[model samples]
Target: MSAPDPVRCAVIGTKTIAGQHLPVLQTLPEAEVAALCDIDAEALGETSRRFGIERTFTSVEDLQTWGEFDAVYVLVSVLAVAEVSERFIRAGIPTFLEKPPGLYSSDTERLAEAARETGTTAMVGFNRRFYTCLQAGREALLDTGDVVSVTVHADEDAGDKWFGEKFPPEVSMRWAYANSIHALDLLRYLGGEVAKVTSVVRKRRLPKPDSFSALLEYESGAVGRAIADHFGPKGSSHWYEARTASAVLTSQARSSPGDRLSSCTLERHGREPVRFGLTGLDRRLKPGFPGESRAFLRAVQTGEPVSFPAPTLDDAVRTMKMIDEITGAEEWAPKPAS
Candidate 1:
């Protein structure tokens, strides 16, 4: 049979994250960047010109009215994700939403409901799940046996350094959901559905809860530990580990220095460890963006489900819910200056 037509894609945001997606989508054989949209005309113009995309719009309604693309990538801010992605899902277009999928688990739930009601395919862009190193490590871990335990240590500067008076209260207060979810999702991705949060320890910080440690029990009887220390002295670092009886897998953050690529290792009993890392494409574009973009476009082009590890709206809902469990909803709410 002849080659399938590329999936014409429209991007709904032109910020840093959107820039990351656009490059991969344009390079993919299965996708075409048909149009670009952003409320900020200057940013839109710059991104459109950079990518050589002629079609541009300042509103989602205008883009929908034009409706020339087969799939839409919603890379808007955390607050706008649910609203924008829901519009496309309601309009019967496949949508690729950036991580978090919404400001809260409820927001993701609403999007999931809309996708189900409209019968449109939707994916939440948990790019880390698409990391080639993580993928290989995950597979190796499973080959050894069941995943008995998984640990994720995500570190960042304090709340002031993170927000720096830039984000609105809504976004800053929900920082864990808006940002930390990227690291937190790895827990569910590796271990499985969390049955209960057995213990939680939080270091109270005024504007936001800056440190947290939680013990998780998964539905598969796996134990999980997620520790996010925003007050750490280290600038920023992340380590993800998953273990089976016979093997262990570990990876550094994708943005690690010297190569801008994650380093991963898999070790089995009585065997030398197997080491792997990201490809040049990952270094060229944002790590994991290329794979995640291809997976989303492939699903759109062929009507097949977005491959495993690329989270769907339903999966986002669970991940977000897990965030709520790890960091109580009350703590995420911003308080007025004293």
Candidate 2:
């Protein structure tokens, strides 16, 4: 195929995270915001003008029923992700979806099947894997040897940002899938496959009973755990970390909506105790989004699949299974016939 012009992309949500995505998409050399879609007619017009998007719609159906964008990015609500993604994937439009593909593993099955049938590329949002910190963590594991174990922590201040409804309920619990999956997938990303998960669930900080710590037994014979809380004291650190025999790696970002300051620390112990930390990181958007979006653009333009991308739908399903076990639900397992 000939070198394609800049990938004309359409974004389907203009909410909080989508707000960040619009500007970042505008900055990518291989991307152009061809259209914007949101249920809020007012917000749609505002984002379209804000991003200089010429075409706008208040519905994904209108965008897909008669749309012409080169690719689609499904940034809709968690409950609506699979349905929206399935619409585009069956239409054979290369799609990039946001995190937590669905509240349950079953929710992702049709989209995965459709992607296979249509031969269209579909990717889930797992930007943490692309973070420079986790990127180095994977390599740093080589020196550590044996993949002993890993630990990840996430802290959120629900002080005033606590809307209590930013995320809807699955009635089966969406907190872990909503984001603990970020750290869960991170553990899997750096440590390897998971064999078993044992987690304690309880309400610690948040307005909801969604905080807990989980022990992970990796299929590679390594042990790890991750803990998250949405309500913490103001200025609490929100970061993830992993440790190896030779060194420990940590990633933390300063709290500023307008600007980003992140750092990764590696502490080594041996003949010499050396400490390495990377500072002044991009914290506004996800550290890995640019690279992730670029990979999508490459795949869209070349008609090739994204190579070893982080957090595929299947991968998210496996993580969801682990979460199910953590919640004592075990929804991923084959059930007994009624």
Which candidate has the top score in lDDT?
1
Worst 10 residues of 1 by lDDT: 252-261
Model 2, CA-based lDDT? 0.69
Point out where model 2 deviates above 4 Å.
1-3, 143-146, 155-163, 169-172, 203-209, 229-237, 253-261, 270-286, 329-338
In candidate 1 the C-alpha lDDT for residue 105 amounts to: 74
Clashing pairs in 2: none
Q: TM-scores across all candidates?
A: 0.93, 0.84
The runs of at least 3 residues in candidate 1 whose Cα sits more than 4 Å from the true structure, single-residue gaps closed, are 158-165, 204-206, 253-261, 330-338
lDDT of 1 by residue, 262-321 (tens): 778888878998987876678678888888888887788788887578898889888888
